[model samples]
Target chain A: MQPQTAPSPQFSLRPPMEAREKFNRLTTWVIVAALLIWSWRGSEMNPMTLFRDAGNIGTLLGDFFPPNFMDWRLYVKEMLVTLQVAIWGTVLAVICAVPLGILSAENMVPWYINQPVRRLMDAARAINEMVFAMLFVVAVGLGPFAGVLALWVHTTGTLAKLFSEAVEAIEVSPVEGVRSTGASYVEEVVYGVLPQVFPLWISYSLYRFEANVRSATVVGMVGAGGIGMVLWELIRSFDFQRTCAVMAIIVLVVTLFDLISQKLRKMVI
Target chain B: MIHVTNLNKSFSGVKALSDINLHIERGEMVALIGSSGSGKSTLMRHICGLTAGDRESGQIMVNGCLIQEQGRINRDIRELRTHIGVIFQQFNLVGRLSVARNVCLGALSRTPFLKGLFGNFAKEDLELTCKALERVGIADKAWQRTSTLSGGQQQRAAIARALVQRAEVMLADEPIASLDPESARVVMSTLQELNRTDGITVVVTLHQVDYAIQYCPRTVALKKGHIVYDGPTANLTRAMLKTLYGSESDDLFGRKEEAPTIVQGAAA
Candidate 1:
């Protein structure tokens, strides 16, 4: 071992930054500041509006005071239907995502397969759940089933992307180990790939389920059937009290499902 | 028995292995010794059909079955692999699965498709896994997650996997490269025992010449993608090694005295 030495006078506490690096850092900050300003103008952001329209907002909110629970039974029933839609949607998505995710992973499949499958997932994810619900409502003629289909398609896209990433990040040696046993391709995936990615997949599925419940509520606004339809009607008819009551129900149900799914996710991971 | 004729492998334009020919008889314990980047691991991988040779080079036959020929693996390579077990240096058992389940995976090719998909091995296969683990002295760790075990234990589990495979040939690629001296002795002795008792043909690659001399009866040496020596281990000498490996002979002749001693007859 080399002998220990005291600090030399030539050594500095911090290294000096090069001119090129300093210039690049300054340029990045300038670009980011310019982009933020441009977006602020494009988005028409106005913090002053809240103070300017305070009276109007107060009057509108006051109209919702003392929420009416006369339609509480209907609100609860439709909320239950929303939960059902989320359940079926999440279950179907989880099933389809397993295969689709494997197909889309670059390490799992060849480029020819992964490229096309990834494009398909991109198409599914590009459109929002509301748009999918609108299209499905036209095809299926407005029902909870349509909402289920919409959430299923969109959630499958999201979950497949997440699942493929997990699969891609796995240690390749375990899969190679399985292959060395003379196991077939599918068997290798089952024994090697799935075991490594199982926990992350479960966590992603639970997270998607929570997000799907929120989407399910809004799908009803497109006549796909849930609490959102009643809420939409009450807003259109200016029944603020009933609308407030319905929003509270939606909040309570979403929170309850989110907590339950969080617990499940924690248990698995 | 295993045979390789004029096998060549190249990554891009640079040759990793070149025009190699070798044959191992049944129940032989042979060691492949080379310095790093000497194509020892690549040759071992080629023998098992895990890696393909150059398109125009040669063919490999393991247990009278064609593993690969001219860069094309046999269509029935998976079935052929069932009879030829391979162990890697990293002990690549699935980390999340139980040790027993990882070992039972050796029976996948024989199990029904649906059964294998669900990881439902036959009762006899499960029993074989138990026996294999017992033979390797890790039966008590059967139900534990594989990642929870020590490196030596994990490596033994891999050996158990090969036992369950009922392989006629066992190829180990630097099985002890990552192990400490004591664990390395245990692993080498285990391979020696299997070759002795079960009559399994064993081929192991090693960078340390001391271990090769102590455990293997036959030694094959590679240098710069070419076979430098293939002979009985007893004929190898310090002068011969210096001539073959030059300055790198020091690495080949590792410090043997620093390695731990084995208890008499414990490995047997």
Candidate 2:
């Protein structure tokens, strides 16, 4: 390294490192403090409420204890129905979403085609699954089919977005290598594009399937059919014991599906 | 079997190639030599119809079919590409695919459309793919994932893919630029073997002048979008290089005669 020159009479040759470090630290702290203050005000929160409301939480926890197992078979049957809803919904979503996923990717289509398809997916995702379940329940009347439709629409939007990202991130030369062989557009997608994205596509689908199972249980509360119907009814009648029982069943089933999906993903990936 | 007349290209209103004219007979191994940003790649892209030359000043013909004229690619260029192969310096294979499967992709154009989609290749395609792999000396690697292969092995697989395509003309854009000297020698020998034995026309771009003189008898040199030299490679002597590249000639041809010739490497 060059030896440091004598300090210039007018100004120093190099910056003051200590002052720069202090300034950077101050700026970071200021930003974090601003964010904390803004969120506290926006939520209308009081820090003292944590201590004041401690007893209310304890009372709720007390009511949740000593869970009842009466009609365990009925709860299991309803849990199976919720699982069925997720399965049928994911099946339909996979069918619809894979094609839309390819179409939505700008690398696969011209912007003219990709733009409208992406907008449609964005619109589908704008509304929450609960709201979609309510609308479908109104349309189809109260049933598991309504829950299926809700999960199908929501998962289709999410999975297609992920699939498009995976497709876009593939190496370009492999596609060009296929094109050099005089491949048509469809052939390019099958041979060049699909192989690169297949593992990621499978991973995304499995993840979506897991998420849909959890969502399926909640949609039943909106009159879309599942164990949430029983849970909601018990809560309304102040049958906290039965509500706890259904909640436990939901947790067990969701965990089971998560484990299955994880295993399948591991085997394939 | 390729002819280019008055080819010109510009990117964002800046000229990349101008007023280029050339012709290559069948089964000629010609080298396009140049410094960086000297229009070698641009010329190769234009020949393959991957990029269009300047409007109203260009025409290219390969195997008697018009690839492009007046900077517009012919609709039939898609069909024409079935007879021409192109290779790049990097990312030449789909890493997730098997070597055999990547070779199989080269036959997709001629296969029935549905067969290509469903991957139900004909018996002829399989036989040809095997033959191609064997020719490239990588038949043992047919079942391996492409990413597992070394750089030389992957490039050989790419060459096998081209052989499966049955391309009459091969345009390689700096195929050995990213390779070591030994691997570069192997690739050059493969191209040389294909040119000599199968009579496939090979046009390759090179930054190393010694490789060009050692492998290709004909040389075309470009400097800043202009054809500075086009003649026999034997005539590209120190005096000629000095005139074409001036002080930078040393950088282009600086490497000594340590690398073996294509024939010497092929025999090994």
Candidate 3:
């Protein structure tokens, strides 16, 4: 008691720390560094090579300066086919996905019903549309049909997953309100669940349709038959000028499609 | 009209209700009074077959039909639901749907299921709904989206749905817990009108003791999942309330200027 104790000082700008927290932070950084090294080696990533080859990319780009228009009609036809593929794929996805979406929504059904369906959807989503398109091209013998099938499978999985989440996030109180009316399970879903999630489902489907349009354009490179085949051919033949024209057309078409669909979606919502 | 005997309920092994034995005659208006987590809501839920009680603990019956026995709900509870209306504190309406459609949902069970999905509500049902909306004084907002309506209006719309359901017994779980004083008065008055005029049995859980006395003739006080008091609302003396609740009894009431010991415990 003879020695007077000092009161704690006021707060300062410098951060106060615990040694344990500092050690944890260092360990995290070490783990992150190790993982980065492992991934770089595994993927064979070399930034130096990309930097060195940057001039060749410029040279390759320069070759496409003046685009050729001789193949305009063929490009337009292929482009339209891509659009049709997108539309068909989206329609199929909507019809199939809506049911699967409802089935997979955990809140809608019990674990036994939704769990297996969700796992099956996971398997569908794990494969890219490009991979599916490649398989479909072999099976269907190379046409827009193959592209459409690939987009349909992939988009169904995606939209179903999205729609299920929207279903899960819906206000449970209204569903309870519906249940108190003695509405059957199907009736509850139709009146209570579907009405709440419908707008969100529509918006998600519209967004997925736009992505499928882009996918349809490129799936043709794997012999799934769309504008991608023409673009792929020009690239392979070193007809860079015509490739530029196709790229320009793809840009214009995708933008227009996106704009129109967005407008429609806005109106519906 | 309602019978609950030897009821016990627990969630995750924690007791929410315990040994509740209550009987209410048809056309009686009762108020359930308690602080938070006092099992008033649990009792109401049990009556409507929304939640099940402990196995081998109790049975609940409505109009001589067993709702649940030994924690098992009867499979034919759907038919029973047509006669009971449950209103929540949140005013559980499908917000995106029109107010009229939300009300029309009460008429769904009466209509064929397939036709209900297609929204083939009958002309008579629509007229009934309009009459219900009129009863709630929201006929002008019938076709408007329910979400657009204010909280008090939405609660009225919910009551209208109950009227449309032709529910004999109404269970309101803190119907005006979120509303302002003026709105709360309107909502309580509407429930009062239903009880006095239509002779509908209304069991309302209330937070404010003043409203319990002002509106409901009878109040059942619950504490720790057990009924501490069940008698005329006028008999809820300050000392009784203090015994029922502790220091927290102060917040359970509003407008304390009136004498609490004035026992107007007249039996109706």
Candidate 4:
């Protein structure tokens, strides 16, 4: 009788694989190494440098503690102004962004409308908010109004892109079903697309609002009227104590904004 | 009454429906039976004015209205759709919405925009929706999220939406294809009851000849975008099925028959 033999294992019969994959892996490693070297060259990212600078960081932290509550009245007023700027800027951005978001959505708008609106949004977003503030300060002559306008334009662009994507990802069946029922295009969008994405839109808008609080303070550094302007002046005079106080106030305000926004996001989404 | 003459539709240079002619009368349940890609769904879509074709190539008249003529479709096709209901295989329920809301959508075209925005459905509309839910035997589930329902229940909810639309003609595209045999029978019986009791015109596309014979009085068969047979359901013979579906006829209809009660139990 013939000797019993084991059956061969089944294997894929495709080619041994492409050299491109190996080349790609090597190229990725090379790019990563080059990026690390390039970043290290100018940043002085050595551990020794960090250790040597640790003392100065500690000194700064020590100065920040027992924060100067001496100008409590002035600080509270400035903090209120900063809060107002953020709130108004975000509200304005939301008003402007919603319509733009609808117009920019490829699924909602026709190509003729969407393409132009997207390009317009791209151009609007390309300019930094600080730059817009500087331009508006020059035109409107320095105030929270300029700062609010700057934040409005930048946030509108960002939120429009995000909200359009949200709109685009909605299930198409309900929209089609609604349209099939003799409903107008506007009605279909209102009923089918809006309900599905409204929660996500609210969540994203609240997230942007949190970011805008930080951005609003920074824009005030360019003489747009907030606590940042006072902090900038204190830093310019090298009054580290008062600067630390302003910084503390800013952190407290931003942290509060973050907590509120998080709560609202949870409720909405 | 609806009339379709010499209907032809093409997609991306491929013919999906060609030289098709059909006439559907009031209160008749016609089943369009065909294999996959045989253009049965496409034909049903055209009848409801969801898909448009060259008007010069064909004429479609619904209730004395010339809906399509000379490569042009009527602008009032939406109004035409109000008189017809469409049921999809997937049951197309918005997952997050309640069953009542899904049915309420059927009345939205008639309700003012502001009313719809606040979900201020008219009392009569609400009553009709509830009645529709009752008719489909899912009234107790009307307030529940549609996604919570079983496949059979979801399909019934879809039927309720169609009923609430007060549609005179119902077009079901492979309604039972996705259901188990028991659920399939339930849905088919529902359609049959609608046709027989309410005098609604029902045109449903089906894959199995057995269901078509059991539920529909008339049958239309298509193969490769062409109508191969159109006659009474009782006339569908093994030879005709063999001719239409080729050697796959046995594979299509032949099966180890299960007890109908077992199918019902599975559905429940």
Candidate 5:
């Protein structure tokens, strides 16, 4: 009898070489070469400059230590104003964004309506908060009022976009179910869409609130009131120590707001 | 009672429903069965006034009210819908809301906006919701978020919402298509029980033939936007199914031979 050899080991039908491997290698080298060239040409960033400026940088940083707590009352008042600005802006934006967001959602509004509304929101969001603050200050002639107006416009644009996308992504079955019950369009939105997105809306509003607190400081640069105005004054006077103190206070306030907002978001969403 | 005559619908130049006529009697359980694109859903949508078709050609009268005639829908279509309840395959319960809240939403048409905003549902409305939930055997889970429930429980909650609507007519669109075998049986039985006990007119769309046989006594089968069969479920034969679905009959009914014995009591 002829000896039977063991069946040959099974071999995979995979191609001997993968095209992706070659493509990845080529792209990796190209990316590294481009980044090296770009970094070298963009700025005359040499270690020598840092070495020369080390003493000045060190002194500027050192001034930040021993933050002046002498003006605690003034700092606290400015902090309260900043908090108020953020709260007012958030509340106003949230209220305005609901209707605008509904109008912008393709699933809720017809294309003719949603198209124009989305374009308006896009235009509103395209400009930065600082530009809006500058324009508001120029129009209203400076103050926390200008800051509030700027924050309102900026937050409305951002929140509208986020809220509309959330609304659009909601399941359609509930809407249809509500419609079948003979509910009006407004009632359908109130019961069907609102329940699904309320948590997400609250979460997004809190997140925007945290961001607005930080932006409220910079709005002061355009003559809008906040701790930023004092920091700007100190910087202009070359009072690095006082500038450091204000910065410390701003950082502390912002960090505390962030923690609160995060906790609230977790609780709701 | 609902009357539909010569209903026609088209989408993107393709006819989805054509010259359809149907009459649904009060307290009758009617099942609409069809292949994927057979116009059952389209016809059901028309009954709910969710879709507009060639109203000039079709006449739809609900409870002596003319809903559609001469290509025009009645302005009171919204009011008509308040008397009809609809359930969906997706359960359609708001995932973030509590089961009780979702059930309470059924009373939104009657509840004032301020009352709804403050969640101040009337005592009777709350009692009705609890009764509806109890009917579906899920009253214990009323306060839980709808998303936390199993698929069967969610569908039950959806049914409870419909029940709380106090609808005289209920339309279920593929209500059990997304459920497992046990859940599907439970949901179908719940609907059957409602129809038998409460005398609510039920018109359900179903993809499974066995379900139509087991629960619904009357079945209307549609094929290619046309009614191929309309008769008692007991009269359905294998040969009729072959004629209705053609070569697809083997795929649809072959599993019938291997079906696990359904525990009737478990469904209840």
Candidate 6:
């Protein structure tokens, strides 16, 4: 240019944010900070108490040292039972979740059907697994079967929610391509939707299995069955040494499963 | 044969297509040409009963079977649609499935529900799938996951799927819109070859008039939802297109000079 000119108006490196957007963003941060502060007080959080009670915790921890392994055989046996309960529970939940998940997916069914099915799933999820274990113990008269039933219902609710979300996020064009072939609805689902969601479904199911294994050990606290009942009895009688031994077993088993399932999930996904 | 009458469509109060009537005989390759927002794809979707027209709109019939009327698709549309194959701008193949399985899915209508559900096709259906894949020139790709294929290859796979359906009429809605020039030519020629040899009724919507002039014997031009021209491709002159599309006609010619050479080369 003959004269030094200002930069052209046509190009902008970045568009300036509107005042309203800036205001909204600031408001959002303020609300989040306010909520966090309010919850901190409401929940009675006191970080100073940790240092104040260090001696009491040390004495309590000392009681758990040199864990007693006298009932190692019983502990191992019950741990196997816990694994079995988790296996059956996860298997049944996966089966039930398949149909329930499809029924609850907004893209798969109408609002009337999905709404009611979602509400039912919500009710199932709203109750804790421990609560369900107590109810099932009463109904089934206490055993591994009661633990299995509790995990099945609770896991079905969780897996169905996960499965439906995967279904909803799928691209609709593939399903339309299937529909154009004059494939029936069930055939379209089996061929189109199922293929797209299969990997994610398997991944979610394996993840739920990991969670269920952790839960299975605790269901026995309500007399549902397995190592948790033994754990509960030891804790109640202040048998801290044996309690430590049982806790160690539970931790080992859960960690091993988590690792195996993570590898499997990675392969599938 | 496909027949559409009084096909009116409106999206929320704005007219997309209005008062249209068309009849396409079997074994004819017709090109539907229009600029974007000209309702060509919308009209094609209506023909196959993929979309419902206005409640006051008239009937659409495919092969003398009622497809849709007064905004309601026929109760037996699933059976009726078996003979109508539709190709989209996006290939729309299931990415995780093998190409062979995707083609076999075309026979799902004839297979038993439970068998199809379990992905167990009949022996004849499998043979048909193989033959269809071979015909489309991608039989080697049959074992590959569909998502691994290139754009042109995936489109060919979609055509193979349609072939396995034994479709009597193929409706391609902007089938080549998203393709490169080479892929576009390949897909158009494949469609042309099918029309000539199989005697299948073909209706393809195209944006570039060069392709229409080269591939289709007859042309139907739509502007603002009205069929401004319906005649032999030889008769649609530049002036006629200019009058119909006004300043936007340049888009139809596909940037002027290139269109003439392609059309002239096809004519020669």
Winner by TM-score:
1
Residue A251 shift from truth in candidate 5, angstroms = 1.8
Kindly report the TM-score of the first chain in candidate 2. 0.88
Mark the regions of model 5 whose C-alpha exceeds 4 Å error after superposition: A1-52, A62-67, A138-142, B54-57, B70-72, B258-268
Against the true structure, candidate 5 reaches a TM-score of 0.86
lDDT of 6 by residue, A1-269 (tens): 23333456575776678999999999999999999999999999999989999998898899999999999999999999999999999999999999999999999999999999999999888898999999999999888999999999999999999999999999999998999999999988988899999999999999999999999999999998999999999999999999999999999999999999999999999
Cα lDDT of model 6 overall?
Answer: 0.93
Candidate 4 local lDDT, B1-268, one digit each (tens): 8798999888887898899999989999999988789899988878777778754467888767776765577888877777778898888667778889988888877888789777788999999998999988999998998879988888898888888788888889889888888888889999999999999999999877888888888999988799989999899987888877886576447363343455543443
Model 3 over residues B1-268: C-alpha lDDT tens digits?
8899999999999998889999888989999989889899888889999988899567888877888998999898988888899898998899999999999999988889778989999999999999999998999999899999999999999999888889999999999999999999999999999999999999999988989989999999998899999999999998889987987698688765556675553321
True contacts kept of 2: 0.75
User: Per-residue CA lDDT of candidate 2, range A117-155, in tens?
Assistant: 999999888889999999999999998999999999988
Worst 10 residues of 1 chain A by lDDT: A1-10
Q: Each candidate's TM vs. the true structure?
A: 0.94, 0.91, 0.92, 0.88, 0.86, 0.93
Off by over 4 Å in 1: A1-15, B256-268
lDDT per residue as tens, model 4, A210-236: 998898888888988788788878878
Better of 2 and 6 by lDDT: 6
**What's the C-alpha lDDT at position B186 in model 3?**
96
User: Poorest 10 consecutive residues of model 1 chain B by lDDT?
Assistant: B253-262
Chain B structural similarity (TM-score) per candidate = 0.94, 0.93, 0.94, 0.91, 0.92, 0.94
Task: For model 4, name the residue pairs that clash.
Answer: B55-B70, B55-B71, B56-B70, B56-B71
DockQ value for model 3: 0.66
The sequence of per-residue lDDT tens digits that candidate 5 reaches over residues B21-75 is 8888898999998878888888888877777777445788876778777567789
Runs with alpha carbons beyond 4 Å of true place in candidate 3: A1-15, A47-58, A262-269, B256-268
- On a 0 to 100 scale, what is the lDDT of residue A72 in model 5? 73
**How would the candidate models be sorted by lDDT, starting from the highest?**
1, 6, 3, 2, 5, 4
lDDT of 1: 0.93
Per-residue lDDT tens digits for candidate 5, residues A158-239, read: 9999999999889888877777766678888987899888989999999999999999988887788777677778788887
